[model samples]
Target: MPNSDYSARHLSVLEGLDAVRKRPGMYIGSTDSRGLMHCLWEIIDNSVDEALAGHGNQIDIVLHADTSVEVSDRARGIPVDIEPKTGLSGVEVVFTKLHAGGKFGSGSYAASGGLHGVGASVVNALSQRLDVQVDRDGKTYAMSFRRGEPGVFDDATGISPSNPFKPFEDASVLREVGKVAKGVSGTRVRYWSDPQIFIKDAVFASEELFSRARQTAFLVPGLAIGIEDRRGQEIAKHDFKYDGGIAEFVEYLAKDAALTATWKLSGSGDFNETVPVLDESGNMVSREVSRKCDVDIAVRWGTGYDTEVKSFVNIIATPKGGTHIAGFEQSVLKVLRSQVEANARKLKAGNDKVEKEDALAGLTAVVTVRLAEPQFEGQTKEILGTPAVKNIVANVVSKALLEKFNSPKRDDKSQAALLLEKVVAEMKSRISARTHKETQRRKNALESSSLPTKLVDCRTQETAGSELFIVEGDSALGTAKLARDSEFQALLPIRGKILNVQKASVSDMLSNTECASIIQVLGAGSGRSFDLDVARYGKVILMSDADVDGAHIRTLLLTLFFRYMRPLVEAGRVFAAVPPLHRVEVINAGSKANEVIYTYSQAELEELLSKLAKAGKKYKEPIQRYKGLGEMDADQLAETTMDRSRRTLRRVRVEDAAAAEAMFELLMGNDVAPRRDFIIDSADGFERERIDA
Candidate 1:
């Protein structure tokens, strides 16, 4: 009888690279800059697998002049010999067959991102041309492909066919170094993205690539990765090999104002807590308390009132966390409740209502969990879906807090006392604000409600998903009011830039006429208890001028929504209005009485004139470039920035809410140094020369 084993039973029967190209989005998410980066990541993942296998130490990523990404690694190159079972080369099987790589084996790689072995094949199917060069067997074997099809033929250096997968030495480079082949081996892959597949647009972003490279540099200690641009010019060259590993990651993630001397809150509270708690022994009582877990808790009071809590599962960011995140939140609430109950008499007033979110206002947290096998949900893998991780994390944190409460050397008595004061302050504000906001809501609901005098409310044709265009100036407002399908499209016009809510308090915001107009029109109440579903329009379009001030106003509006109504931003209902920058009118003698022309921008205007000039035509009337939305007529306004079918809208995204909140505090708050440093750091990306000014 044949010795049959699990390896034979587990082999994948499916074949070919056709599925990837047919449904590329399934493999790489989408064909955009993000997807383009994903292609590089897939190849880099192969090298990372090698490192994880303890085979390679060095990896290099380069952007070639021809707009192709190249990744090289000093690892055991893919086997070039024919497989005994299928009579196919290892490199060919890897590139052409799905789930064909060795990482799927029991002992190939203990942990890897590409467990199913679909990375290389998927990349191959989506690429225009791929060049694979392997340094092995004292020879260099090279193969080329166009859109996953073999091209030209295979070329190889001098090496015996019997010993195919020997060692390395790309002969020319070895000769250049004046050394004989020393059996050092590796693999290199270069690929160009297919323009047909990337028709919309997919291009390499060197900076974002470097950022990811730096992430890998930090993730895997003792691993070196070097990145170079198309010009072979070293842009960012860093070797991150940290022996301290995750402890370093923890330290980096725990940075906040409270962790440093820059802590703004250092107050003298009147009350103190003296509670005797049983120790872990249960019999012995201790006055001392200490949070045993080195969770490195840090908090900062930003200029704005927003919360961003980021959690990670095994170094991978879980923006939308699961069980572990829930435990952390529960632990925080537990600590807050303990402190509040202990100092209930000392708390000024109304401290109970300020919940976890209140305590975490302008807060940034990083919760990292180390698990055996983290279960991630979905293809994007942005969330931790593990079931047992919850209990593990919760137990660790709860015990630590309990120990802290029973510590013999407890000093949290002072910290907890001050926190009670802060909670009370927030409580007072919440109560007053809630009352005031409720009264306004009732008044608005009772009366025709002084809905912004300038706001031209279109009839509610249907409660279906409709939109409202908040354009700048009364002229655009009037035009949009006339042209919009009143039932489905509402129009609200603002006088100028709305208040920068990032630097202003809720009270300060009420004074801004423009902001008030928006608030009144939205119908959905703002501040603490804002519900996005109650928003009058399914979408909000910010229509403004085409110049710098318009941009500033747009930023301000974005900031307001992000700081106050973040859920609205997350729901993807917010969008920017895109209107044409120019309009052209054509005229001829005895032509139609309603004769006119249309152009969108300077380029379009120039092109129209060039076409007319080529036809020896002359326009009796000239064209006009609209600097502001007020310049457009009702029909033009509806066609360009109002009509859902023709209009262009840019949706706002809180990709990193924590970073977004930090940005607002730094840019719009009273901190000058942080703002200056931010501008300097992002100078390369920021288009404006005088961003702050």
Candidate 2:
């Protein structure tokens, strides 16, 4: 049933900054607190760009009392003259118009993080009010904006007699305020976010902002960055200035770990390629062109198992890691694998090659590149997409590693040899563990069967369509087995809460019967050997009762998956099945028939009862509440929790690795004081009316 009135006339056009307001997520990613942080980042990036171009050395950030922010830099201020094409002042144009900055084609900046030149305009559009002040040519100029529109001053004064144009009309929106002494030049920006556009009030987190400021100082050497929070009664301030750059960052990250050695490599080169050129004849001619690149790398290996690698382009963090990361990984793998093999030959060890994972384990490294023109993958710039950067970085790193490790006069007990030995030991340990697991599997098969006997297998052989439900207690298992669709759903019943693997080693975890059975059923291996491709089920769901004990059991199982079978959780294959907690029965005014309504929460139950009361429908005396899954019959269980079409499943994911790790440690570790304090703080929010017990 298509509408007959639809035509081309219905299409609407969004002009100027309206498109950004209509679709804020497309520009800043989201309208949550994260988007507010991105807005602050946009303003800070301009100051950072000035530092990168060697124009400034100091950046100061202030969090004001009115939820506004101010960023000041000791760099060349933004242009105060009129732009010929737009016929508007440079400062006014930069804040009001999109894609109007010095980065695009001005050639005023060779390498910079603010590549798109849309930061200032985007921030202005999303802000409620913004102000800009520039000090240049021994005079201070000021201008203001409200929601991306230039503001007019009520009483303007102190105009320069020699000035050619008016202060506020067609020339610059700025008016001269004060005279600068001799050599003071810079730009200052102050902005407040629009409350209507953000989900929550745009409140900045001090710790997160401080971390970013420190990281910027580390990325750009010889730059001083300071942060001041003046929103509270007691003002707090911190300063960061790092001259050692990324090398110091690596050392800081590896301070707590047992490091073998720390090394750094840096190089620069020209990328010569062919380009199209049009001569006087109007024919395209092939001409040789060259682009310059600078690369710096720092690496340190520790005794832990986590690998931390951060990459950047022109002082901008690239968390998603594109071609540059791939090149670095490849170069490290090649160099380490060769070094390990050579050492093995000299020591007369068996023929064993180190895998990429083993070589990179316990490694902390930072990769940075600066080029004349960097091509990023997107506006957010989470990845570097330049093709030549990959080869250049790989070549520089490989040559440096070879010279360091394969030198003729190198000592046998040098730092390189020590690192090689550690990597070899890791390789042998992994091989031995795999061999032992295979042997145990063979022995178990010879005795009877390798599969766990308690598992109720599914009929489908296709892994993509199959699901595995790990049920708690035999009572609930019986109901789930009867209710499940045997064609694609399988059930495995555990005795009780499984072992808490957070405090246990890998060997100890695998030795537990309950943990071992679940691992064998998953078929994805464990720990470092875990692979998503070998998983037996597409969705591994944990089904438990809707009670306190059920929550404890679920937590224990999650701990196991997070510690030993992390790849399964990381691949988005883990889920939690939520069952309804209450059931309401309503009867018509004169009829004996009853209408049943299932509610997942107490609020929903109250609403349902209220609606029935208003409809004048009589109901039973007491509603039936489910304490455990064992209370439901096969049909009831299928309708409430087991049916794929009707069931509600929550997918588990790790959005922030650092936060997740800290949370896990606080809740699962053996520290009693922190756990007690956390419970006490959270108890105030707990509603006793909702707890069935």
What is the RMSD of candidate 2? Answer: 10.8
Which residue pairs show collisions in model 1? Answer: 137-167, 288-407, 288-408, 289-407, 289-410, 290-404
Runs in model 1 with CA error above 4 Å?
1-14, 49-58, 74-94, 100-105, 133-186, 221-225, 231-256, 259-304, 348-356, 370-374, 400-432, 442-693
Ten contiguous residues with the weakest lDDT in model 1: 260-269
| Top candidate by TM-score | 2
TM-score of each: 0.54, 0.63
lDDT of 1 by residue, 559-583 (tens): 7787667788888889987777766
Residues 437-536, candidate 2: write the lDDT tens digits.
5543422223544578899978776789789999999999999989999988989999888887665544457678999888888776776776677677
lDDT of 2 at 606: 82
Clash list (residue pairs), candidate 2: none
Candidate 1 Cα RMSD after full superposition onto the native fold (Å): 13.0
**Maximum-lDDT candidate:** 2
lDDT of each: 0.63, 0.78
